[model samples]
Target: MSQLKEIIYNCKKATSLIERKEIGRLTLRESVELKIHLAFCSVCRIFRRQSITINSMVKMLFNDAQQRQTKLDDTFKKSLQERIEDKLNKNGKKL
Candidate 1:
């Protein structure tokens, strides 16, 4: 049927639906279409898996960065700068 063909053959639409599903944005029709497409499409299924993985990694990276919002104190900054200067002087490199 033409409907079946439309559902099963649109990789681009399926991939867009996958991303929309990840972000909780898929409409009911889109959700059904993506599910039907994924059921028959191995390549799109692989893409969906990879997209989930990459999304999780990016989320973890941002979460870790947010949790580690540390700042160096003025004294620590000065000490680090002095150490760098000393190293550069020893290597005869002027900054």
Candidate 2:
């Protein structure tokens, strides 16, 4: 039974690799193990469902950000530029 328990735990860890891979964030060993584990685990099947839901949420958040525009108006941008230039001048840095 302990062996079955360890297999279940490893399967959960492996499902995380699906998201990690999407973000360019997995080691080669992790990638291979996740593939191997997924091949045999039913729990990993449920984990994939949860992973897809979370990934969809992330995609929606990014889409919302892309649809929104910065509230910084022209005057604000100008003020920011002036502040940066002032700081650079004070430090004797060429702008």
Candidate 3:
């Protein structure tokens, strides 16, 4: 039926909105349509939850790493340059 088809469409749209949380509020028609679709669709519900969980975990991990610096400092850089120059001079290279 046309009404059933409309319900399915709304449900898919709502799942997408829930994933992004950008849909403020649905009209009465949209609310009814989404409810009907979600009532029978378990996969969409699970997907929305899992996406949230994974996003949160990744954000936390990134925040922790952001507090640490992994690169060498100026002294280390100078030491590396000296080693390279010494090796090059020993080989009679201009660089």
The model with the greatest lDDT is: 1
Poorly placed runs, candidate 1 (over 4 Å): 70-95
Q: How high is each candidate's TM-score?
A: 0.67, 0.47, 0.51
Quote model 1's TM-score: 0.67
Q: Which residue pairs collide, candidate 2?
A: none
| Ranking of predictions according to TM-score | 1, 3, 2
Return the clash pairs for model 1, or none: none
lDDT score at residue 37, model 1, on the 0-100 scale? 98
Instruction: Report RMSD (Å) for each prediction in the order shown.
Output: 8.4, 4.9, 7.6
Clashes of each: 0, 0, 0
lDDT per residue as tens, model 1, 1-95: 69989889989989988998998888788888998999999999999999999999999999999899878899999999999988998999855
lDDT of 2 by residue, 1-95 (tens): 67545644685477668777766787877766776677778777777878788888989999998889658799989999999988988999754
Per-model CA lDDT versus the true structure: 0.92, 0.76, 0.73
List the candidates ranked by lDDT, beginning with the highest: 1, 2, 3
Indicate which candidate wins on TM-score: 1
Give the local distance difference test score of model 1: 0.92
Give the better candidate number (1 or 3) by lDDT: 1
